[model samples]
Target: MTGASAGIGAAYAECLAARGFDLVLAARRTDRLEALAETLRNKFGVAVRAATADLADADQLEAFAAEIGADDTVTLLVNNAGTSTLAPVADTSVAAAQAMTDLNIRALVRLTMAVLPGMKDRDRGAIVNIGSVLGFRSLPVSTIYSATKAYVMLFTRGLIDELAGTNVSVQLVAPAATATDLWDISGVPLSALDPAIVMTVEAMVDAALAGLDAGETITMPSVEEADRLIADFDASTLALLGASQKSAPASRYLNVTA
Candidate 1:
């Protein structure tokens, strides 16, 4: 599990440990990671290793991915490490935007690639990618953050098709505004948002796990009528594909002589 230090990631570690899975938790905060590891070890009688690495740094990310790739015992990978910024494109600093992209998109992709080959070889494993509902509804303030999540959503969807015949499964989880430190870090505290829209961290993780058990490719924890939305999105994608197969550009783009 990446981002295993706090919030959703820490919650996942607890749940997975209780289910008797020895864990390898990765995050930048050594203090929190080690503490969580110790708690899980004492409470669940499961072995837990805390790995501290700043994933936004290329060297650390590559090294961590290599280590996980070589671990044949790893049966599941939860790509939960991500960062965000809530500012307009122009207002956001280039360094901040790049760091968010590196952690959210680059780290997730590298880690998933690290585990996939071993999982395919073993023919039994699962990958859970945490995305956001902002991936589907982009806002001016969520420019880079939403784009990163949209990448996760599309990446997971394509992987599902690629792994169709294989025993390995991949799930994309798009959570809305969850009650996590992410809000504070993004400069938008949970109290600033509507209480009704915020989901408890535990509830979100539980629903995501239930969706995984039910073999759902995409899980939306907050959406009550998620299936209908998914179906419509899929149908629209198919329609777009069919419409794009023409030999020339559409008449709307053509210059017609009247």
Candidate 2:
């Protein structure tokens, strides 16, 4: 589990540990990763180890990848290391944008690439990408972060399609704004969000696992009725198909040349 030191990634690590899965926790923070490993080993009687790498650094991640890529013991991959940028694009620092993009998109994709060939050879594995509700909706302040997550969602779905005849399961877990370090980084007040609607970390994870068990590629824990979201997706797909027709513009756009 990459990014297993904190937040939703930490929750996934814990859940998998409790389920008696051996783990290799990867994150930039060595101390936090080691501490989490010790706890998982003590509590769940699962073998746990820590691999610390700043995934934003190419050299570090590549070295880490060489080991993780070939290891047959790792049957599950949770590519969940991510950061956030919460500012208008005009004034957003290049560092912040690059950091988020590097961790969220580049790290996730590279790690997946590293482990996928092995999994495909074994014909058995699972990948759960931690996405966000913001992946579906557009928000002004979190444009880059949201866009990266949107990529994850689509990428996971595409993988699912590609691996349909195989035992390699790919899932996308979309959680609404849960209480995590992310908000603290963004300086967004928890009070500003609807508290009643927010799901606990456990509930979110449990629901995602349920989806995994049920062979659902997409999981939305906070959503009660499935059709609601399906309808929205269908409408968007319909719009996409309509756009492909490339018809003439409406009467309003017609040139009324004098």
Candidate 3:
């Protein structure tokens, strides 16, 4: 698990540890990772490794991927390391944007690539990608972060399609405003969000795992009508696309003189 030091990542580690997954926790914070590893090892009696590496750093990311590729016991990968940008585009630092891109998109893609070949060879594996409910929306302050997560959701969905008929299961877990440090970095406090809307991290993880157990590729923990809505959206979109493929312009565009 990447970003297994805290927040949603930490929650996932705790849950997965209980589910009998020996863990390799990677993150930028060595102290936190080590502490978490110790706790899980002691409590769950599961083996745990703490890998300290900043995924935003290209060298660290490559090394981490290489290490994961070499580890044969790794049957599951939890890609949970991510950050949120709270600022508007004009106010956000270029460095922060670049770092987010590196961690959220570049590192994820690289790690997935590194793990996929082995998973395919073994014919048994699973990947849980952490995404956000905000990925489906155009939030004002979190535009780029939302875009990045949208990419995550779409990327996981693409993997689901590609890995079909293989034993590898790809899941996208999209949580809705869960109690995590994501709010702090996003310029919002968890306490400030409506209590009704924000779910506890444990609840979110449980729901996500439940979705996975039920064989869902996309899991939205907080959306009550998620499945129905997604089905409708997909059907409507396909119908729209089906109508757009034509040999000539529509009647609406035919009369245009320009």
Candidate 4:
């Protein structure tokens, strides 16, 4: 698990530990990571290792991925480490945007690649990628963050197809407003959002695990009618695919002048 120091990641560690899985928790905050590891070890009688690394840094990320790749016992990888910025694109600093992209996209891909070969070789493993509903529709404040999540959504969806025949399972968990420190870090406190939409971290993780048990490729914790939305989205994508196979441009574009 990445970002295992707090919020959703910490919750996942607790749940997974209770399920009798020994854990390797990774995050930047050494203090919190170690504390959580100790707690889980005592409470669940499961071994937990806390690894501290700033994932936005390329050297640290590569080293961490290499270490994880070498661990043959790792059967599940939860790519939960991510960062976000809530400023408009023009107002957001380039450094901040790049940092977000590095942690959210780059780190996730590297870590997933690290665990995949071992899982494929063992022929029994699972990968759970945490995304956001913003992936489907971007807001002004979440433009870049949403784009990264969009990549995650499609990437995991494609992985599902690639790992179809294998015993390896991949799930994409897309959550809406969650009651986590992420809101405060992004400069939007939880109090700013509607109370109705904010879910507790425990509830979100539980629902996601339930979805995984049910063999759902994409899990939306907050959406009540999730199947309908997924079906409609899939149908629309298929229709778009069918429409794009023509040899020539559409008749509407042909009549237009540059």
Candidate 5:
């Protein structure tokens, strides 16, 4: 489990430990990681180890990947480490925006890539990536963050496609703005957002697991009306199916030909 230090990641750790899975928790925060490990060990009798490393860093990431790669018992991978920035595109600092991309998109992809070879070889594994409802809906302040999550959703779906005959299953958790430290991390005061929009961490993980068990590729916890969302995504995908990429520019581009 990556991002096991706080928010959804920490909740996932607790939930999985209660179900009898040992954990190698990785995150940038050593103190919080160990603290959570201790709590899980005491409360659930699960073996927990803290892997302190900034997964956004290439060297640190490769080392952590080596650790997971070396462990044959790693049957499940939960990619929950991510950062979101709350600024309009023009106002968002370049550095902060880049950092978010590094963590949410780059690091997540690298970690998944690292685990997949072993999972494919083992023929039995599961992966759950924490996404957001914003992946489906546009939020002006969360544009870049949502784009990264959209990548996760599409990436997981593609993995599902390629791994159809394999035993490894991939699930994407698209929770609405959840009750987590993410609000603060994203520069939003928790009180400023609609309380109803927030979901508890435990409920999010539980719903995600239910979807995983049911073999769902996408799980949106707060959306009780699941069929509508599925239809929406399907319609969007169908619209794109007719898009042309290999052909030359259509007549619509003739006026701008230079």
Candidate 6:
């Protein structure tokens, strides 16, 4: 796990440790990572290594990627490290926005690339990407964050398509307002949101794991009818894609050629 220091990432670490998976926890905070590692080791009797690295830094990211590439024991990768700027595009700083993009998209892509070849060789592995419910809709304030998550969702789905028939599985976990520090980072207090919509981090991770076990490509924890919603969206998307392959432009665009 990339952001194994806190919040949902930390929760995932605890859950995975409880399940007897030895862990390699990575984060910028060496102190926190080491503390979590110690706790997991003592509690679960599983090997835990703390890797301190800022994934937004290319040098650090590649260093970690190289380590993962060389280590054949890695069977699962949870791409959970991400940042968000929950403000209007006009007000958000360019540097902060770029950092968010670097961590959320670029680093994720690079890490996935680093692990895939080896996973294919092993014929058994899984990649779980942390996405958000906002990925499916247009939401105010969370515009860029949602777009990045949308990329995550589409990216994982595309990987699922290519990895089919292999033992490798790619899963996108889209949690809906989970109880985490993300709201604090986004400048929204947890109390500001409706209590009914917020789910505990444990619940979210449990549902995501269940979805992974059930062979689902996309997992939306809060949605009661997720399967129906996914089926409907996939049908519509397939129709649109099929229609776009026509030989000629549609009548709607005939007179409006640019």
In candidate 2, position 147 carries an lDDT of 89
Candidate 3 global CA lDDT score: 0.89
**lDDT per residue as tens, model 1, 172-256:** 9999988989988887777899998889999999999999999999999989899998899989989999999999999988997
Ranking by lDDT: 1, 4, 6, 3, 5, 2
Model 4 poorest ten-residue lDDT run: 182-191
Residues 85-137, model 6: lDDT tens digits = 78888888998789888899988998899899999999989999988888777
Task: Flag the better candidate by lDDT, 2 or 5.
Answer: 5
Q: Estimate each model's TM-score.
A: 0.97, 0.91, 0.95, 0.97, 0.93, 0.96
Residues 1-258, candidate 4, lDDT per residue (tens digit)?
999998999999999999999999999999999999999999999999999999999999999999999999998999998888888999889988998899989999999999999999999999999999998889989999999999899999999999999999999999999889999888788899999889999999999999999999899999989999999999999999999999999998897988
Can you tell me which runs of candidate 6 are displaced by over 4 Å? 256-258
Clashing pairs in 4: none
What's the lDDT of the predicted structure labeled candidate 5? 0.87
C-alpha lDDT values of all predictions: 0.94, 0.86, 0.89, 0.94, 0.87, 0.91
**Residue-wise C-alpha lDDT for candidate 5, range 1-258, written one tens digit per residue:** 999999899989998999999999999999999999999999999999999989878889888887787787889999999988888889889988888888888878888888899899989999888888888766889888888888888888788889998899998888987888888888987779888778889888899988888988888988898868688878888788766654778887778957
Per-residue CA lDDT of model 3 for 1-258, tens digit only, reads 999998888998999999889999999999999999999999999999999999989999999999999877789998989987777989889987887788888888889998999999999999989888877775788888888888897898899999999999999998888888878886777778888888888899899999999999999998889899889977997899999999998999887897
Predicted candidate 2 versus true structure: per-residue lDDT over 57-170, tens digit per residue: 989888878889979887999988888877778767898888888888888888889899999999999988888888876688878878889888788878988999999999
RMSD of 4: 1.1
Better of 3 and 4 by lDDT: 4
Candidate 1 stretches with Cα past 4 Å from truth are: none
Q: How do all the candidates rank in terms of TM-score, highest first?
A: 1, 4, 6, 3, 5, 2
Error at 250, model 6, angstroms = 2.5
